[model samples]
Target chain A: MARVVFTANLHRHIDCPLQTAPGRSVRAVLEHVFAAQPRLRSYILDDQDRVRKHVAIYVNGERITDRERLSDWIDDDDELFVFQALSGG
Target chain B: MSDRLLVGTKKGLFELRRNHADWSIAASHFLGDPISMLLADPRDGTLYAAEALGHFGVKLQRSRDDGKSWQEIPAPAFPKSDTDGLSVSYLFCLETAGADRPGWLWCGTIPGALFLSKDHGESWTLNQALWDLPERKDWMGGGFDDAGVASICVDPRNSTQVTIGVSTGGVWRSGDDGASWHAASEGMHAEYYPPPRNHAPEVQDIHRLVQCPAAPDSLWVQHHNGVFRSTDGARSWQEVTTIRPAKFGFAAAVHPHDPDTAWFVPGVKDECRLPVDARLAVARTRDGARSFEVLTKGLPQQHAYDLVYRHALSVDATGTRLAMGSTTGHLWITEDGGDAWSLEAGHMPPISCVRFG
Candidate 1:
C-alpha cells in the first residue's frame, strides 16, 4: 500500500488517496489514481491514454514528462504531484 | 422552480422562470431593440441587461427581488469630450466585481468601451484610460463591431486589477482602480484586418479571459483563432490546445474558487456555424486550458444550433451551478459543472445572450 497526495489549484485543502498495489512505477500509480477517481482520468490523459499536453506530473519534487511509463519505479516515501500547465495571456 | 433564466434577444429582453410546473415568460419588452447581453445580480437578485440596438444605446436595466419589478438605470454613453471615443452601438458584457460590493458593475460596450458603476445599477463612469490608451491608435477594425470588450475579468481577490480583452486591439489592464491602464496583450494575438492585411495574425482575437485566484498571474484566453495560456499574468502566452474543425465561440468561465477548472463552447471559425457542430455542448479543462474534454451528457441529441454568447456563461459561488443561456432561447444548468447539463428553461426568441444571478 502506498500513500498518494492529490491537489488542484481550486481547493484550499489537499486530498490524499491510499492505494495498495504490487506493480511499481509512475504508470501503475496513475492507473490506481484514475481507477479511484474516474472523472480525473480524462483530465489527466489524452484520447490514447497518454498524458495530455499542458499537464505536468512530478514525483518527489522531480517533474516526470513521460506519461506512458508514468508507473516508473517508486520507493515507499515518494511524493507525487499532478497539475495543469497554464499558458493564456 | 426558484431559479429563473433571463434572456436578451433581437426583439427585446425576456425572463423565463418556472411557475406551476411550467416554464413561462416572466417579462418581455422591446425597450431597447436587439438586446445583446444580460447579467443577473446574485447580491440583490436583480437582472441587468445591455441593449445592442437603437438610439436607446447601451442602457442598464435591473429587476429588484427577482423578476417582479424592473428599472432602467441610464448607464452613461461615451462622453463627447474624447472625439476619438467609440460610438455607443452595443453593450457586449457586464460583470460584478464580487458579492462584497453590492452595486459595482463593470460593463463592456461596442466600439471597445468599458464602464464602471460604483452605485449598483445606477450611474456608470467610463474607464478613460482604456479608450485614451496609446494602443487605440493602432487598432483598425476586426469587422465584427460586437467583438469589442468581449472579455472582462475581475480578480477574485483584488477587484482593482481588472482585465478586458478588445478584439484586434488586444487585452487591456486597469491596475489602479481603473484610474490608469496598460496593455496586457503582450502574448495575445492581434490579427490585423485591413484592405491589404485582411487576415490578422493567428491568436489575435481573444474572446475570453479567466484567472486562477490561487495563481492570479495565470490567465486563460480563448481566441477566435486559437486558445492560449499564460502563467505570468498577460506577459506571454503559448498555444496549448487547438482542436481543429471548431475554433470560434465566446465566453470561457473559470470555476469561482477553482482556477484550475474552466470551460468554453466552440463553434466553427469564420464560416459562421453554430457552436461546435450545432450541438449544445461545453468543452472543459479541469487542469486549466492545458487540455480539454467535450462535455455532452444531457445535451441535445439532434445537434441544434444553440449559440451561447460572451455574457452567457457563469459559475456560481460553490462552483456547483454552471449555467449558460443560448441565442436560441434555451437555458441549461449543471450542478456538477459541465460534466452533464439539464435544460433549465427553453423555447423563446433567438436569445441574444444570457447571464446568471
Candidate 2:
C-alpha cells in the first residue's frame, strides 16, 4: 500500500494538513483522497482529469507529470506531496 | 420565465438564451465595440451594460425586462476643462442599495471614480469624497493605467458601511454611506507604488473588496499581489493569500452567508494576455483566507484564456449559487457550492464583467 500527503501554501499560510490514503497506484491513491475530500479535486485536476498545469505532485520525492499514469506501481512506504507551482513576475 | 444571458462582444451587446437544447445568440446589433461590463439585477430583472468605444470613450446602456430591448444612459460628462478633454471610462460595477434603499445604485469606474445613481440607472453623481481623496495623488502612480475601481460592496443591513477597491489604491472604507472615506490599505500588497516591498503597494491597488454584512468591519480584499483580511474595520489587515502566477487576473466574489467562503481567479502575469497557455481556472478559499482550492472541473483545458475582471464574479443572495463570466466568452455556474461547475455559455465574446440577476 502507498501513502499520500497533501499540503499547500494558500492565502499566505503554510503547512496545514497532510492527506493520507492507502492504495497501490497513484490513481487509486488519488481516488481515495478525492472520496474523502472532494473540494480539493477541482484544484488538482482539470476538466479532462489531467493534473492542472499550475499544480505539481511528487510521488515519494519523484515528480509525477502524467495524470492518467497514476496507476503506476508504488511501494507501501511511498509518499506523495501535491502543491501549486508558483510562477510569475 | 426565460433565463436570459446578456453578453458583450467585440461587436456590441448580444442577448442569448439556451432554448430547448440549443444555445443561440439573440441579437448582435449594438455596433461591435468591446463590452466592459454586463449586469443583470435580480430585484427587477433588469440588464445593464458598459461599452468601451475607441476614441469615443466609455458608454452605459440598459434593458428593462431582461435583454429584450435596450437604451443608452447619457454618459456623465465632466467639464471640458477638468477632464483634459478626455471622457471617463465606462462603468465597471452597478450595485443597488437593496429593497429598503430602492433606487440607490453605485457605480465604480476606471481610473478610480465612484458615482451614485439614486434613480435606478438614470442620473448620476460622483462621490467627491472618494474622487478628491488626499491619497489620490500617491495612488495614481502605478502600472499601465491607474487600473480603476473594480470592487464595491454595500452593507445590505447597514448601508452606511460601504467598501470599494481602488484598483492599485488598495481598499477604502466609508462608514457614512460614501459621505467620507478612509484608507484601509494597511498591510495590503500594493506592487505599483514606489518599491515592490512586502505589502506597501497592495494598500493602494486593491482589485476587489467583500465586506462581511454581519461583521461590517471584517473585509476581504483581493489586491494585485496578494489577498488580505481585515477583522477590525480599516484599522489593520492580515496577509491571507499571495499569487505569483504566470499572469494576473482581477475579481473576487464572497459567499453571501459564509464570510469565510470566497472565490478569485488568478491568470498569468499582469503583462501577459494568455493564462499560462490558455488554461484559466477559478481558485476558492473556504476558511475565510486560511487556504485556497482551484476549481477546474467543467472548464476548458486548451485555449482557455478567459480573463475575469473584477465584478465578473457573483453569488446569488442565497450564496448557494456561484457564477463567473470570462473574457473568452464563457459563463461558469455552480449550484452545489462550487464543488462542481457547469458551463452556461461556451462562446459569447470575451466577457468583460458579470453580475447576477
Give model 1's TM-score versus the native structure.
0.68
Residue-wise lDDT of candidate 2 within B1-357, one digit each (tens)? 334455555556766555674445666646556677776766676677776654334567778856667776744433234322323555566677655676677787766678888777777777889877877765652343655677777777677778777765667778898999887677765554455554553346676777766566677776666677787876788877443342255677777667788777777756774566677677777786666777778777787767876666767666766767776678777766777777877766666655445
Instruction: Please state the error at residue A5 of candidate 2 in Å.
Output: 72
The CAPRI-style docking tier of model 2 reads: incorrect
Instruction: Write model 1 residue lDDT over B305-326, tens digit each, in one string.
Output: 8777766777765676677777
Which segments of candidate 1 are over 4 A away from where they belong?
A1-89, B16-33, B43-46, B53-55, B81-86, B97-102, B140-143, B190-203, B212-215, B242-245, B275-280, B301-303
* Candidate that would win on TM-score: 2
User: Alpha-carbon error at B233 in model 1, in Å?
Assistant: 2.6
Q: What is candidate 1's CA lDDT for residue B159?
A: 80
Q: How does chain A of candidate 1 score by TM-score against the true chain A?
A: 0.72
